[model samples]
Target: MIISHKNILVSGKHQKSIVTDVFYTNEIVQKPVVIFCHGYKGFKDWGAWDLVANAFAKAGFFFVKFNFSYNGGTVEQPIDFSDLDAFGHNNYIKELDDVESVLDWITTTHTEYTDFIDTTKITLIGHSRGGGIVLIKAAEDARVQKLITWASVSDYKNRFPKGADFEKWENSGVYYVKNGRTKQEMPHYFQFYTSFIENKERLTISRAAKKIKIPHLIIHGSEDPTVSIEEAQKLHAWNRNSHMLIVKEADHVFGTKHPWSQQYLPNALQKIITESVSFAIF
Candidate 1:
């Protein structure tokens, strides 16, 4: 398999947006394509994603995993939290738009892979929060033939605290949450909540998952603390055609972390990647 990293200027929320993509392909002539979207605080090179991309490419698919425009990375520096302002200002609607932009660019603008890509067969894969984004995108975009989520959330509203304080948040200009690891205060402007509330009907994960007439797969870890296995069950329940698989003892990242090393993947993560490829093909 040949794996290469490149950058593309995608139409973003602002004037000019840059996205870094990890492209994977074997020497095969033309192959089905899978485009991956990372979750919050996730970039294209996060942990073992590159390895996963390679695995998919080796299995005879053209895989591309990209960093969201507002994912805190830049064209100059495609890794880490160098652009917190873009990260803080990001919202679900913008992400959905970004993914659409990427798809449009690949299918219409990118010429080198035009003959090598089977545009008719396109799949969108997302992890964690990104899973919700893909679900919504798939429901709305008929171009997406298959949808898959890794440790996906069934509902975006559940991420926030409920009740009358919702109005309190509306009045406040911004809300802050602590990153347990980085210890940096993450500021979610009131506009985030407002945008979500305004677009709730369009952004509902369950609604999107349920409406998906195409094949869907939900993969999660039984011991995942970040997103419970039940979330996977909920996604399956919402989409009767969807298949759910739970790894017995994998964590949120499937046993991978930042600055990860060692070539071999954890047993559970390998299973997740393998099963995802099988589902995509089947």
Candidate 2:
């Protein structure tokens, strides 16, 4: 039977709490650890993630996923954007620190769950913006044994605004982007760009990819409109030893969307789960 633990709080960047979830069997058998990081504007319970966790747990792996401390979700509400102020203040560095905190909790602090987690065989999986975070973390942390990214961005600097738009943001201090689903205007403070500039070297995904010595798997959807397939190719090009998989006709979310009502994983997402589980085991 799959044992699911939800909404466990962990200390995160700037003392903010990170909402976490863990899934595994009740067997207490040592299993390889898989930590998942959600992307920008993402939460732990987004879409079909709960189903994803159950899938991993059933496959004989201890799966963990968490929300970034400042992803705009509060402890009471771990889904959707509840606090835009916190979201505006969020930066890549904070997200990285949050991942580290989760790592520490799973490996050393969470004694109750540690019995089922193989500390030395931990793998980090990230989606979209999170893909970059896990890549950089895997490069810096020795605990991570394998790395996987889904629809990840190759370059962060390019994603930022340029010229007039950037100047406008700098002058205004913050910019707003409409959340198509929620119809909410999300704010991105100029500090976000400044923080990236300050930590440019450490946040470089290309450099991290080159530094990772463990097995790295890059997965992307060919039809992904949010992040192009070439980004995954770039990651592959940087790490020649890395393997890449392109899901033909799959979109950014792998045929899944917010408020995913289906009980089972989508066909494209199931393919990813199979590939990822195989990668972690072998």
Candidate 3:
């Protein structure tokens, strides 16, 4: 199997461009498409994601991964958090718009690859916050045929600061979140909360998951400290028809850390890719 890669930029909401990567092979005709959405502070080049994309491509599917327009990564620097201002202005609604914008590009501007892709069989795979965005998109968008989330959050409400931190945020107009791995100061503007209030129903992941008429897979880590396993159970309860898998020892990132330099995929991360690809094809 000859795996091919393409890096493209798609125009997104708020005049920003979403930097994306396309992985596929010319071996098959009309292969399925899987769009991967990175979570908070995550970019297309994070950790072993490139290897993960290659695994999916080798599994007979066209894989697409992209950095959200306001995900703090610029086209020139797609690996690090270089655009703090854009990150501060990001909101759930804008993320939804970003995913839709990518879909529009794949279905329209990227038609040149129609011979190698089956547009009707689009599947979305999101990790963490990206998972929530994909859940909402799957419910609202008719083009999404299947959905999958890894270490996903159950809700986006109340994720902002609280108490003294909340007070500081209200007074300062922006709150800073420290990225433990990069040690970079990330900003979350007050508009992030206002946008949630403005589009409460539209941004509700649980509500959107309940309305999904297609197959859905919920993958969570039992030892995940960032998002408890209970969140996955809650997602399964809301969407009982959806399948759920709890990897016993996996962490928030399934044992894959940033700056991962190994040529081989970590065991836990490989398992995640296997399950995701299996569910996607099933």
Candidate 4:
């Protein structure tokens, strides 16, 4: 297995955006491709991801995981919240564009896996918020053959606080949410809401899921606090063809943190990978 990390410059809202990718290459030609998108406040190099990528590569798949362009990480610093400005400016539409750009890169620019990856056989795997983005993308893009979401949110509108004065928020221009662990106040500009409202028709997960005619898998932890298992059920319910799997006792992040310590796989995460592998291959 040959694993390499590279920086990619992607076209974005204003200027070129930098994204990092972890590519797993094998000698075999025309292998199925698994493109992974990280969750909110997550990076490609987050805990256990390297091991997960290796696992997929070992399973005879060409795996690629990348950072969303505005995921708060820069080319110089690929981990942690070093660029809050970028994070603040991020929105769902931009993420969808980023994924499209990555797909374009995979189809046109990247040469290392040119012969190894079958662009038509691409599968997208998204974790948490990334899952919502993938669902939207898969519905619109015909290139995606399979879709998988782990602990994903069914609705993007639910992310914002309810019963708020829209006029005040529009006037204030920004709202802040406290990151309990980091103790940092993350700001959401009014543009975020405006963007969603403008793209509401295109961003609806249920709407997208209903249009998806390909294989779809929804996996979530029964004990997930961040995104309840019910949300997973909702996603499955939206798509008649989707398969839903709930881990017995796993919580959000599958019992892993930003700085995960254990060298071995957590039972819950291992189960997710195993199930996903089966879904992707079958």
Candidate 5:
């Protein structure tokens, strides 16, 4: 039977709490650990991620997924954007530190789950913006044994605004982007760009990808409009040893969407999950 520990708070970045969830089976048997990081504007319970976590648990792996403390979600509310202020203040350094805190929590603080976790075989999986986070984490931390990225961005600096728009953001201090699903105006403080600049070398996804010596799998949807397939190609090019897969018609979310209500995963997402499982196992 799969056991799930939901809505647990893990201390992270500046004492803020990271809302975390863990899924696993067989309490007595040690299983490979998989830590998943959600993307920009994403939470631990977004869409079919719970299903994905259960899939990993059923496969005899200790799976963990968490909100990045500043992803706009609070400890009381782990889904959707609740605190736009925190979200606006978020930066790459905070996210990287959050991942480290989760790793520390699982390996040291959470002794109760130690029996079911294999710390030495930890794998980091990230989706979209998360893919970039995991890549940098995996490169810097020796604790991670394997790495996987789903629909990841190859560059971060390029994602930032340039020229006049950049000047406008600098002058205004914060810029807003309307969340299509939530229809909420999301704010990005100019400090976000400054933070990235402060850690530019460390936050470079391509640099981290090249530095990774562990097995890495890169998966992307060919039709993903949010992040193009060429980004995956760039990742593959940077890491000659890494494996890449282009899902024929899958989109950024792998055919899954917010508030996914179906009992089963979308075909494309299922295929990605199967591939990820195989990659994690072998």
Candidate 6:
């Protein structure tokens, strides 16, 4: 049977705790670890991600998913937009640091996982914004053995506002992006924009993709509305060694929606999970 643990807190940036969940079998053999990073306005427990974690666990991987320290989710409640203030203060750099903290907890003194996981064989999977962060991290961190991105954004600069909107955000110090599902106004502080500018070179997905020597997989939908399919092609163009898979007629989330009560993984998600498991193990 597979063992799963949730709400496990690890220390991360800004003196905040990173809430996480780990899924793995209690088998004696060492299993490769898969660390998943969620996208913007996302938490660890959103949608059918628990099922995604289970799918990875069943596929012989010690799957892990965590909220960024500033992801607005607390240890008591690791879902939804609970703390918008923490969410607003968040930046890509902090997200990178948070992922590293999870890595550190898994590979080192975290005794609960050390015996069952092969920390050296860590693979990272990110969706949308998180995917871009993974590319940047995998390029710099030697511990990451493989990488996969689902409908990932190609660049950080393009996501931010431009012209007057940009000027207003800079002057006001924050901008609110309405959450379609929650109907809450989510804040993206100007520091978010400033962070991108400060670390422009390091945060560039194309630059990082070209530098990645290990295996990489790009999974995206042909009709993704949130992020175009061209982003995937651009990533592939930079990293010629990487493989790209486009799901026909798939949208951004591949039909997986929040509040998903289904017992099984969606067809699109299942395909990528199977493919990701294969890619990570190979």
How do the residues 1-282 of candidate 2 rate in per-residue lDDT, one tens digit apiece? 999999999987587899999999999789999999999889989999999999999999999999999999999999999999999999999999999999999888988876798888999999999999999999999989999999998989999888999999999999999999999999999999999999999998899988989999999998999999989999999999999999999999999999999898899999999999999994
Q: Quick one: how many clashes does candidate 1 have?
A: 0
User: How much does candidate 2 score in TM-score?
Assistant: 0.99
Off by over 4 Å in 1: 26-28, 163-168
Global local distance difference test of model 5? 0.93
User: 141-210, model 1: which lDDT tens digit per residue?
Assistant: 9889999899888888888756776666667766666766666677677777778889999988878878
Which one wins by TM-score: 2 or 6?
Answer: 2
Give stretches of model 5 more than 4 Å off: none
C-alpha RMSD for every candidate: 1.9, 0.8, 1.2, 1.7, 0.8, 0.9
Task: For model 5, give the 10-residue run with minimal summed lDDT.
Answer: 9-18
Where does candidate 4 have its weakest 10-residue lDDT segment? 7-16
* Candidate 2 wrong stretches, greater than 4 Å: none
Write down the lDDT of every candidate, Cα atoms only.
0.82, 0.93, 0.89, 0.84, 0.93, 0.90
Model with the higher TM-score, candidate 4 or 5 = 5
lDDT, candidate 4, equals: 0.84
Residue 244 local lDDT, model 2: 96
lDDT of 5 by residue, 41-87 (tens): 99989999999999989988999999998999998888999999999
Query: Which pairs clash in model 3?
Result: none
Clashing pairs in 1: none
**Winner by TM-score between candidate 4 and candidate 3:** 3
Model 3, stretches more than 4 Å misplaced?
A: none
Scored by lDDT, model 6 comes in at 0.90
